[model samples]
Target chain A: MTTGVRRRMGVEERREQLIAVALELFSHRSPDEVSIDEIAGAAGISRPLVYHYFPGKRSLYEAALRKAAEDLAERFEEPREGPLGARLLRVMGRFFDFVDQHGPGFSALMRGGPAVGSSTTNALIDSVRQAAYEQILAHLGITAPSARLQLVVRSWVSLAESTALLWLDGRRVPRAELELQLVHDFAALAAVSAAYDEEMASVLRRILADEPSDGPFTDLVTRLVGLAPLPGSV
Target chain B: MTTGVRRRMGVEERREQLIAVALELFSHRSPDEVSIDEIAGAAGISRPLVYHYFPGKRSLYEAALRKAAEDLAERFEEPREGPLGARLLRVMGRFFDFVDQHGPGFSALMRGGPAVGSSTTNALIDSVRQAAYEQILAHLGITAPSARLQLVVRSWVSLAESTALLWLDGRRVPRAELELQLVHDFAALAAVSAAYDEEMASVLRRILADEPSDGPFTDLVTRLVGLAPLPGSV
Candidate 1:
């Protein structure tokens, strides 16, 4: 190792550097598999310095978890100024990027199994989803979403999470194709919800009308129409 | 204890009895929580008798897992002599019943994490899904499904598993309503697939036409219309 002079950094900068190192380690392996020594070693610092920023491994892990969650939530806060379908596509692209950036950690957070995950990590993960739900409602221009709409959005998120987790577990097609398929599934589920409730129906109708003809939403609905039975046939 | 009646049974009967007893215990607790003595006691037999059927806890767990899979697969094999929607509803009803009957064990099996589950359990779980896929294909009268069809069905199964798992974990509405919602989701996914693939679209169109007006398929399609934007609106 080059024994160059270590640059003095601010407290926040040091903490950020530690968290970044921890995130990289945890991304490829479970938190249990990562050691504080390894993290410090990778960052060219001492274990005591690591504990100064984090009380222990759990805190360090949670810090990394939050950073990842914050990163994901911030990404989802994309510009909502475009066609609704285009906006959703951008949001989906962020979701894909999160998976690409974090790799196994993304799957671990999404899995939420008790062995390698803590309640704190799970809550952080939930907040990320909650952020997505709020962003979706904000995009839809609904300040206070109806209860049914809330459930619909939340269920879709869970579905998306499971699908992505399974894909990351090696049941993957091309990432682009799967992400597009996810966008279609989201639209399809919204349509299903609108079918059973008038509130949802109007909400979905308004959402669809906000999309352009060339957007993915149009492609999704148009395709569904052909699979639909001939008019009056049923 | 009154040791008056130990029935003379065949080897298969005795093994089945032991597995049934073990399954009852496993339904509420993971395999590690269920002791060999408890399983033998539950079966009204001695510890050595349990060992006679299975060498250890892992083997007993495997046997119970196989029994549950068999029971579920058999249930999905309902008579294929009805309206396609009716047949699908019956199959879905069986899926719901399996969850209800097996309870927590169903969730654990579907979760398939490394803690309590192994490669064997995971494979058994996949076999359960495989059986459903075959049953669905048989119901559709398609002897040889295309590659795309296989992916579509597998993905739908994964979605259904996630939905059921979330419901069982207590994010549930009324049991009947959620099951109906699941049926709708399945139809919607098929419609999504049909949009891009001509074979799937034709298959879905035919299936939709076979449903009665009062069925969930009709309700689902009808609801979708209200949510669908007018063709020229986009």
Candidate 2:
């Protein structure tokens, strides 16, 4: 292992290796609790060499965060095929997969850990959220989102975030149900918005038109019907 | 005012005065931006006199935050009457009213400003959220909340928080609509959970039984029906 550490490696390879090591370490414990020395030891490199690749623990944490953010953002990207509800459920599965895999790091990034209030850290998290929002818009096939539509999308994004954070505290709720519930949550948010705004109503209409009879949205409707029949409906 | 400041006062009175002054200053701007001298000036007292009452700015901020937290927790208190929807709408109104009045302070409190990640601050905010959850459960007239019921209530609390934070960024939507929308968001969140768990379904049934035809929950059901009529109905 020592010989392997001494083996020739390109600069980019060395940086990526260090980031991977840091990410693995940060995954279990908070970035604050993890030390640069521990990272160096895990990477089988000297402390000086670790600093050679990254300036400090804060920088390394940000790099790892950026990587996690990118990976998490990609999770939100599902193929455009299939019903909207199914696509969202698939996206949520991958989203929670990332959250489960990168529990502490995800919490730190979302809850503002070492770089609390840091603009760069904020921008990275915002980018991931933006990616999710844009992906939803693309799925909706809406070129321009109305104010209410934007609100609905942003609110769902926040809901998913808070839900994941709370779930991370204890794995009490089953992950699978939470994933489908999130898909339903997205529809629930949009449905409420649709009731208030004509633009949102049209958006919801287009979404429902594409959904199948057994999708998560339909499941939500089925559950709602069990509570009470819609008044004035035959 | 300056002469009044020079007059003798009880120590507790002076301390309370300082906290109030700091809170007023922090309400407009982030606590980090506010200064001890400014707090003193606002209270018509010298900087040293301000120090005489409080140890430092951080302590003063915490004191002010405690006050804000108490006030915010109180906002969730609504007499259980009429219907849950109207009661929740009233709670949301008061919640947003506090948000509107204490924009920066509210942001700081929720987003972890000045004392970012401080346990005291975190506990204070958590206490407020806990208060909200308990108040909601009390309104539902439930002593033992199921896991799904807990999830629904907690998720609604988080939704309300993010909604207020976003609304504070830009007063885009009408306040009245946002308030009602938050109520709808709560019902929507609960509705989704109620669909999943039988425990939640019964909770929903009891809630619906008391709600009037024109209540927000009924409004949500009406809106949902507009999207797509439930299949095999009638």
Candidate 3:
């Protein structure tokens, strides 16, 4: 490509282009198996120019992973003012649809080889997962965020992750059947939450009462308690 | 080691000994990272003898994994004829307790490293998970299994796997809190199953009316129909 054409492209555009190309490459092979040379060759750019954009393959991989995560999180974050159950079903439907459309990307994230040591890929996914958890907590009208919320969140996300992978792997279960099963699963989960909320609330109260003086650990504890069944649980 | 000592140990004893030693080594490190030489060295046996029992490292790793899985499955299969919810909680509790004690084995399986291909691990876990699923189905008195059962089995196993990993990795949630949450979660799951059963039974009745001939595709269709909700309504 001409230098003028390259010069006209802003950083964001170039980054997006690089991520698009890298994602395409990584989709076909494990991230470790894909090399900078291959990526640069595929993008029709020099190795130095690729380095100029991303410090290394690790950075490039992180950027691509982050982009994919952002895409996923955006789908879940679509505004909806409805009952918690309805909203959850809508988000789950979107999630299943996203997985169907981006099977390779979803597979790579869930079953990829050892990620490039503590990169943004994990943090991005964790942040999105946490956001989803918070959404559930909010929907529950959980007054105090408790450890129960964390467990429930973890359970739901784990279920969603495994189901998506199983379906993508060509399991015989139809999507509509899977969706209805999920709806029932979440409803049951909600029922359990209702039963245990009071007990969790008592635990949160005790934890708050026993709170220590200020520090990061204390902040964490306070935040956790806030998330518990008590007011300001997080 | 004396010949007398070796002869006294039966084949079962020797096989168990080999598996026990192999689990210790494999759990601490990836299969590729732990060489046959190391396993031999640790087991106080000749490398050739270790090879005699297990053909290769891959076989050794698979044996270790299978042994761990069998141990876990056996724990779940322990006789318990209580209410379905209570039986499930007992089985799940046993699962969590096992993971708490044997975190390394569970982590290794969850990591699903290069040594164990996805298909290999999936096949291994499938039988073990299927046993638990069958138990649940039997308790629910659901005849004629469906693809939905597979999804439920997959999701439940995944929840247990992810929870154990998170707990092992030192999630701040206290152990007692975690256990309580899981019990509640399982209860919710069972409630959903009860509701789904009603929907599935209605669907099954309708499909039975058509009475398709038995064939591979018919089996697939039967499985699919069994998984879905009734056509009339929930």
Candidate 4:
């Protein structure tokens, strides 16, 4: 009976409400197909009111993208107290979950992340990637990772993103299996980078030292370093 | 030049010509941006003539995609002689080269390879991926690759593709180093997969047995294993 009179939300709350509506619409439809009127109607607000908070559709889309990127960045941030592998797996699990929940919206934001957007939008996406890289390093307890360590981590991050996209686009394998494979790829890259970079060699030494001998990492090192009763054991 | 006296090309050649022109145009613009008129005009042909060979603009775009996919698939195949690592390095080199040449077009075709495209177009793209996977196994001489082996290779292919796209999108690392990193990834994955699948474990043994001393592969295994490394790892 009192439906005509609505409670007024603060500026931040209003902006967030609009973005949430826009994000949901964008998840189901391409950006071009989703209109401001639809967004306003979906939020039960006037078109002019939607414009008051955001200048235009592009800006609103950018905000939505940044929100997604922030969600991902936050998910990537975990306590760096656990064993590096377990910590990475947890982060990866959260990442997969985010991908599952966000599906199409995640694809829209990440597909051509920097390609179809402005430099500012691109930088926002880059920030998410950088945040993930830094979190992984922190989990490994590396305060000053070397150039090779940096490259390996950077490339591996790209690989993880690509894998995530491919999974969302295809008949995705089991999430646990995919997450395990990513960790294995990171470990492999660490060992591989060590072959070419002295800093990486030291990093791998630490990784090897931290790992249990009967673990997957240990078995991986054993298989790669075949004919070994465990090297660097002297 | 004999103006207005163009030589008559066969239907296949004419279609190839039209597709080539479309591919070049799509390279610099999105599929929606490139028009049927522009494609025909660019090829110095009439609009109806362009449509004569293809049903519509979407079909034309699909043809362009198929062309790029074929180009990439061709580049990934290489003579599978000599060391496996060396052979892989060669294939990666070609892949990087292809990416460098077709940066935008490659991205266009691959950005959503199977995402938004029609099933036929998606199938064209899938065919390329399947071809690359088969070629990789061929290089390894695996006639009947186990499920784990298939999974590892399939994931690696996805990784390679993602890396290529990232390289094109971002500041690219040096070709040799990036290629080496991929090789390392494949080798490491093989070892890791072996932990879960006995077939992979046996594959690693054969890989180890084939690698020669005083080579990069030998050095890699030694450095990864660390310590004495089985005296040249023979």
Candidate 5:
């Protein structure tokens, strides 16, 4: 009915509009489930016009994926003004926001499974992961991360990723707790590495020195310390 | 040359032989790269004979995947005797052994991407994860895991999966250290939950009590405790 008086749009505007509509539809369900007619119907355009803009559904899906990948990569960005733990917590909050909002799309992107998992799609997802990695490195202020540090950072990134994917499934735990726990996870991972490598210990010390008493890292320290018995008191 | 006077195999024996040959070839490369002709040639039989055993390539691929899944699932099994950390280390050793030996096959199985990733394939992969999860819970001796414990265990499993996937890419880190770190990672993940949850804390205490001084969990505690300053000296 609304198509009776459709507003005209430029080529680029129409393309952008189509992608936005497709992204919205794909975010709610699997791309395989959504049809081009449905996409055009939602976008208030003809089905043929949808193909006029893109070769096929796969192209449109890839376009939507590219946009999602960009948005997700930016979720890792935070102002470098606070303690590392707090900064990471803020990042996790935003990261989870995206995961919560785009549950299906996030799963498809992260899983890289049957739903249009091309080499290009894999690269796009990898780009998002790489962006997050670089942003964390920037926050850590490290130009050359040691191998153990790389393992810690990379492992934490994967942990956050899988955490988001699993969280999306049932959301069994509270979002706030999961976000803070992820921050704690980062610290715990680095602390383990620090215990093994002296270079990592120095990195950890430098990061911990700037943390506030009430920061997540300090909270982790307090919690872990609670497990320890007092020297000569036990 | 051996085809001149090949030994005759029974129906069941030939079927098993074909699957073994297919698994060997698929494990070496992606299933897409290996064709029916190749499978037959590898099996020292004709392509039609390969089809006689199975309907098509997809069925054979699924059969091979099923076998691989069972083997991978068994990798998590260990005798319940040693300290938790040592037991986990042994499990990780076997896990990486599979990952290291079956590099391409493991990637295809874990990624569940283009290499014949049917729903059946995904179910098989999930079965392996469930098996690993249950095995870890059995090690913890918990029939009813709290939400937080479940999160820790599942998160550790995902962490181990991703760690192995990433490790396979470049193998930049030493295999032995990565295995130990994964054991440490399980403790680290559980320790964080124990920090927040009394139930997890008690479980951690029980596990830690059984751990020897040089065990991985004990090593994690010692390493983390070293990061702390003296109560009065500092």
Candidate 6:
């Protein structure tokens, strides 16, 4: 544990170290503004070694973004066994906390740039979104998923991300107050699942009470009634 | 109109013409990709004249954005005499249609370089958001609004914008379906106002039943509960 011990590190450790340093620097300045030389200087390593780890600034930024996305995914995955609404709140609470702790880095990544606007980073975000959607479906016990369900999930995620950004932007509300408001908003939105079920049941009852149907109109009405709320409803 | 007649216009008409041309060009290309010279060329005017009108590409973009913001404000100011939920939906429907018609131009302004990052442009967006918030408060008959209410409106706006973008991205859902879903979702969220009022009413009833004294807790609860739901709640 001596100051000069200089413990040898693994290749993976060095790569992570480079990404961490790069993320820290990218937060204060735009990607174009930060140079590999500065990253190397900050990390107490030679420029060549930094290159050996990341190949270039673009690659480094993408890697950092991927790492952060993974971290977020893991956070959401942690509280998976609770009631649907409570679980969602827990996951969102963690997410807001992450934004608060890493405000600059999250903002930089969320505000994408040209160099890092590749399919890789997008797929990373999509993965997180898809995972959350699947969790909601499972919690709801939705036997057959529909396109409407997908839209709802996407909309909710979009709302959560935008709200986090606003909260980060020095909105006057405290985090606890924001969290309470979100719980109410999100829970009410989620209640649409029950409402949709009720509406569908009523449509079915009316159809059954009617004379034999002649066309596809009855089926269409049933399907429509069962459809999920649109994206961003919540 | 003859060519000469159209060409000879007042300064205000010419400035408007320049902004229209700039908005058109911005729709076709990223803001950074479009140049002042190109805007001038597209407008059938000299670069110096374009500069005389807009000063630079940034200024030109800002002007176009301001025009869009003003249009939105005007739409929001339209008569909203109806149930609160219906009124809110009508206003949002107008917004969605506007975004649909001006998809590319709005996208350019929202996600464009410098436009998204510029403080001035962000301020313009904030101002538009404030106007929308005010309209929501007026519709709900909520006096002395809380931060929570503002957050709800902001969240709803974000949701509406995100939904419009998804539709513009060519999602399979029809605009009619999206609109219906939004209405249902909004109605559900708006229902929370009733719950808030009910909670306050119960607190008052309890306070009055227990003692004749109006304690601070009773007064606080009374004030909280007296906050009515947006009109039209059962």
Question: Mind giving the per-residue lDDT tens digits that candidate 4 earns over B86-158?
Answer: 8888889888887777677667666543222455665786798899999988877789987667777877887
Per-model DockQ: 0.26, 0.53, 0.16, 0.18, 0.49, 0.12
TM-score of 5: 0.93
Where does model 4 exceed 4 Å of error?
Answer: A1-65, A80-83, A103-127, A137-150, A162-174, A206-219, A222-234, B1-15, B21-62, B78-83, B107-126, B137-148, B165-173, B210-219, B227-234
A1-234 in candidate 2: lDDT tens per residue?
Answer: 356545787999999999999999998887778989999999988999999989998888889889988998999888888789999988999999989998977786677633543667777888998999999989888879877788889889989998998889777889899999999999888888888889989888877877788778877877777776455642
Model 6 scores a C-alpha lDDT of 0.60
Q: List the residue pairs that clash in candidate 6.
A: A155-A232, B200-B225
Q: Provide C-alpha RMSD values for all models, in order.
A: 5.1, 2.6, 12.4, 6.1, 2.9, 11.5
- Cα lDDT computed for each candidate against the true fold: 0.75, 0.84, 0.61, 0.75, 0.85, 0.60
Better of 4 and 6 by TM-score: 4
For model 1, the stretches where C-alpha displacement exceeds 4 angstroms are: A1-4, A7-19, A25-66, A79-83, A104-127, A137-151, A165-174, B1-18, B28-63, B79-83, B104-123, B137-150, B169-172, B206-219
Model 5 segments more than 4 A misplaced:
A1-6, A228-234, B1-5, B228-234
RMSD after Cα superposition, model 3: 12.4
lDDT of 3 at A30: 62
Residue B51 in candidate 1, Cα distance off native in Å: 8.6
- Evaluated with DockQ, which candidate comes out highest? 2
Superposed Cα deviation of residue A29, candidate 5 (Å)? 1.3
TM values, all candidates = 0.75, 0.94, 0.62, 0.70, 0.93, 0.66
Model 6 agreement with the true structure over B172-220: per-residue lDDT tens digits: 6677656655655554343332234443233323323442223222222
What is the per-residue lDDT of model 6 for residues A1-234, given as tens digits with 9 covering 90 to 100? Answer: 467777866999999898898877876666767889999999999999898888888799888777777777777664435334455557778887777767866665565545444557667777877676666555545646555555666677777777777677666667754554455555444434323444333332332334123222222222222221212211
Candidate 4 chain B weakest lDDT stretch, 10 residues: B225-234
Q: Score residue B18 of candidate 4 by CA lDDT.
A: 95
> Ten residues in a row with the worst lDDT in model 5 chain A?
A225-234
TM-score of chain A taken by itself, candidate 3: 0.71
With candidate 4 superimposed using the best TM-score fit, by how many Å does residue A40's alpha carbon deviate from the native? 9.4
- Clashing residue pairs found in predicted model 1: A195-B223
lDDT of 3 by residue, B185-234 (tens): 54334334433455444433332233334321123223222222222311
